[model samples]
Target: MAQKSAVAARAPKKKASSWQKRDWVAAYIFIAPVTLGLLVFYIWPFFQNIWFSFNDVNKFNMSTFVGLENYIKLFSDKEVWKAFGNSLKYVVITVPAGLFLSIFIAALMNAKIRGKSIYRTLYFLPSVTMSAAVAMVWKWIYNEQMGILNTAIKAAGGSGHAWLTSPSTALYCIMLVGLWMTVGYNMIILLAGMQGISVTYYEAAALDGAGPIQQFFKITIPMLTPTIFFVLITSIISGFQVFDTIYMMIGKTNPAYDDTQTVVMLFYRQAFDYGYKGYAAAISLFIFIVIMIVTVIQLIGQKKWVNYD
Candidate 1:
């Protein structure tokens, strides 16, 4: 009887039920498209880019292994360094300004106000608008002669200056457009974070004789730090890759083009205009490195300010 009991205890476990197998199969089927897309579009291209960076690729699509030549050239390239500096400048200017503006707008919108949905829709419209269209409209608005901006300036007893044509102002002009485009989206994200905070905290602070400003600093900001961190990281990443606005607003012929050209713009010019695909690939890798380093630094710094609780 003891031997039989031991045998029964050691009996093979039952196979997984048919229902479990079917569930797994169904999940795989549901995810197949996205998995395949990532493999083909992102994973394959990423490896190919790395391979191309080490080779000299001609217009015929033939490659000759040149090893670190492209990378070495990048260090001495004046245009490359200028582009990098411009990209960093854009990030420095836009990220903080955008963050603060979004938070301020979100705080205002979070208050009990009339036509809140209308205001949100109006603000978010710029985010949904096509980039190309936004560029065209802003181009008209920044036109040196007839733009409304210049018109307004002249009407105010001030001289009108070329916003997109002058080297001193072109990059900053593009940065303003970028800020206008992004602020609404970031504001909505912050508003969601604001709404998620429990009213109890604010009520408790109010009972403690905390005014609105005091409650905002003491209760709202601490809880919103996580969302702020997320927005900050994403903004930095996007700001570093600024290209379209510069490309559209400051074309190659424009005198301000050099002042405003970003790293991606340099890549575009190298790959297509100059037909140096390998060099372009190297430039892309450099951009990837910059973004990764910045992201890592922000991640490390977040622990000081981000409140996961």
Candidate 2:
């Protein structure tokens, strides 16, 4: 029996070849840079942010451990709530609007029309434009007295209002700019997803006497689920982290700043401007938790509808 077992074991069981091992090694080598980058840049910073959040760090040093003192201050602060509220409001108003418009534009762009490339390029312009430049241009356009938007309102026989300067409208104006710049980016991604879908489904739908609208709702939308999910997640992530546009457009010292600022913007102000590093870290940590919660909810919900091809 022992001899029989030894023969069975030695009957040249197929091992993974050296070439396969070499290929795996080569792939790991190629991925090493990105893996190392994540470890150093992302992972380390993440842990450090958490550590800083719990400590009474100052300008010169990570001086003392305060153990949730910063967090306590965050809860009792009215300004923190204002900034957080602004961020939540921005997310609520922007996400759905952006998602709908992006999908609509993407559908239009996918159509076989004359000058399609030109249209795509035109639509994508805002995405390529720098945020600083866009903010500067929009700042001029939102000028209370001389801006083109107010001038247009006056031309249309309507009252001229301070768009960005007004607390009532400043956040909305910021949202509008965000919508303009990003809608096309999401469109591009959706368009790519549309391209990946096989036309046979559409052809099949047509053969079944389905109209274009029916085909879109029943076939296109279902197949595009994964893409929509990706776009939605990314947009939410970006919207929550918004800062530069708010800073440049709203101005740090603007009267409307508190109403238009985000949590991240608040963090920046508290950390760099006020030299409250620990407080900023605490705010940052809260923002991180909120983002994580949103993302996890989306992931859980997506399991029901995200179609894989």
Candidate 3:
């Protein structure tokens, strides 16, 4: 009994199997490159941009810390205010418009219809196409002379005006292009969300004398609120940061440039064109602050409307 008790008192330490170690090694290997890229590219540059914002930076990257001088200049500058307002207008128009159109189209696409696959592919093609190419195509379409739109207007006995050269219409033209490009992607996202919903709820609603429109509002929309919220947040961010399409379609020399200039475009012009790197950095930081505040507001507001259940 004493010998057995002594033997039982000595316990062997357990070790992880080689396979477990191998699994951990594989996981780290898979994540290493992404981690390194984020650190070197995103994280580092973000901090550098913040540092540069407080200083007067030169082309050679030399800087003198000027505290809030750069920010002060930006706040006082009429051009900065104009560009910020333009960006805000862009967000206001595009975000809600894109969300509404996308939800509407997605609902239609989700319905029982022929050629649904083809319609989906056609809509998604714009998302895959390069934005610059898309912008160029739209630019020609909006050309003052010999453009398809102008040709159509002429055929209808209406005067053909330069759509992109007039301040009143140029921003709207840009917004339209953004809408065209964005609707498909958001539609697909919403369609996926709609598809994820159980059909039983819809069927039950149908059995309860609920019409299609009624089913859509009472069942589909409520269940799809989470997806809508996701798309809304992303759309707001993208809309606020709109630059490429505007830059490609409305060149710097365009008469309506000032009216259509987005915040990012203004930042580019200030940083690269005028060589005010510090001021540009400040502008970028301001944009970051705006986006952060808006996103936080959305997050807080989501509790009221974004239903996960």
Best by TM-score: 1
Pairs in steric clash, model 3:
none
* TM-score on alpha carbons, each prediction: 0.94, 0.90, 0.93
- lDDT (tens digit, per residue) of candidate 1 on 1-309: 999999999999889899999999999999999999999999999999999999999987799999999999999999999999999999999999999999999998999999999999999999999888899899999998999988999999999898888999998989999999999999999999999999999999888999999999988998898899999999999998887777777778998889999999999999999999999999999999999998998988888555444
**lDDT scores of the candidates, listed in order:** 0.93, 0.90, 0.93
lDDT of 3 by residue, 207-279 (tens): 8999999999898898898799899999989988999999999988899999999899999998999888999
Cα misplacement distance, residue 8 of candidate 2 (Å): 8.2
Q: Show where candidate 1 strays beyond 4 Å.
A: 1-14, 306-309
lDDT, candidate 2, equals: 0.90
Cα lDDT of model 2 by residue, 1-309, tens digit: 999999999998789899999999999999999999999999998898898888888888555898979999999999899888999899999999999998888898899888989999999999999999999999999998999998999999999897887898999999999999999899999999999999999998899999989988988888888899999999999999999888888876688877897899889988898888888989999998999999999998888555443
Clashing pairs in 2: none
Candidate 2: 10-residue stretch with minimal lDDT: 300-309
TM-score of 3: 0.93
lDDT of 2 at 182: 96
